[model samples]
Target: MSIKGKVAVVTGSAQGIGRGIALRLAQDGADICLVDMQIEKLQGVAEEIRKLGRKACAFQCDVTNRSQVFEAVDYAEKELGGFDIIVNNAGICITKPLEKISEEECERIFKINVFGVLWGIQAAAAKLKANKKKGKIISARSIAGHTAWAMLGMYSSTKFAVRGLTQAAAQELAPFGINVNSYCPGIVDTNMWTEIDHGCAPEKGVATGETWKASVAGIALGRAEKPEDVAAFVSYLAGPDSDYMTGQSVLIDGGIVYN
Candidate 1:
């Protein structure tokens, strides 16, 4: 699946899954625009892409802010000469009991995970349409989006919203030749999962590593997920092989959820 000469914009690309996707796309011969709140980390990823001989730049933007996202997209397109892919990988997960999930937490999660994706799609769609270019818009979802877990009520709800928006945008953008889709990952060993493990450690009465271990035990593959696992799938979707597939949230959860 070669995406040579294409340009991709990846959000939350400072590290973890987003960083992995940015680097993978670069490796596959695509110029990349790395977007994240961490300016230093973003620059690091950008440097790596440059080392690989790809034109890359890092943009500091908060996904939750629609204007910032639009500006970032515009900047990326200008710097990269054109744009073909936008991965709305910037998201947040605040694990807590249902009773403990405050309105502020819920709204913040939606703003980042749900609204952020929406803003990306809207901004990218406009640019792709204006350029008369077909594009791919991908977002990050989760297995919890398919089946809600005990302490992740709010995060699950946000991913669920992402799934919904992906389908809706896919259908709406079809006429413009822009495909919208999402990837649902399970138990990726990223900092997000580390935070989940630590946050639920006391409430679940388990040690920090135990929560992640138990979750892995339930995986049919019996293995922990890595950021590259998710990135590989995203790379496929970003490439031309997935042009026929849209309005869908493909799961890469190690068989954690079958939907």
Candidate 2:
């Protein structure tokens, strides 16, 4: 719970869920390092953190590009005093019918979602090793990764990969005292959903808040997730209390999966 002097790097922290995570961590006393492709937006999030009186910096990074990722992580370490926690929050989702899914689309999704997580892990592991501290590696995954969904085949596959990577990395890094885990959120009110909503097939019904609300009505808890909701969990993992939890995926799905 006490992370007063700790440092944390959150990928894709410019907005939505990632932004929520960054702000939560900053408020909890972690020196925040934000990574995102959009420099302008990243700057805004950085400014917000600074207003909270916390040290915050934003790095423009394309996680799919290994060289850029390496440089960004190094820059983060050098400029922000190296990070004590790595949040692999950068990811992408593409919805298409199985037959209509293109090879290019699949690769792009994997590059960002799966490979991106790998890049963050590789870069942060080195930083943690150099600092001689047992650090934490956390990522955002979706419930779609755990359960199969129609028309979300490509995204589901990538999510599954994220879950596997987290488990394997946990095993490999446990000896070094580094912890790795994944956060699985379900049907959250995120920009991703907004985009999907706007493009929903007419047969699926009009894209409205009521329709979206009904979609998740099957959940036992009866609610959609909020970015801040997930951010709170990210804070716990980055702090000391979750030091014992690693290489596991925590679901923030509002009991939808269980329901």
Predicted structure with the largest TM-score when compared to the true one: 1
Per-model root-mean-square deviation over C-alphas: 0.8, 1.7
Give the Å error, residue 257, model 2.
Answer: 0.6
Candidate 1 lDDT tens digits, 67-116 = 99999889898899989999999998897899998888888898999899
Off by over 4 Å in 1: none
Q: How does residue 165 of candidate 1 score in lDDT?
A: 94
Clashes of 2: 0
TM-score (all chains, Cα) for each model: 0.98, 0.94
lDDT of 2: 0.85
lDDT of all predictions: 0.93, 0.85
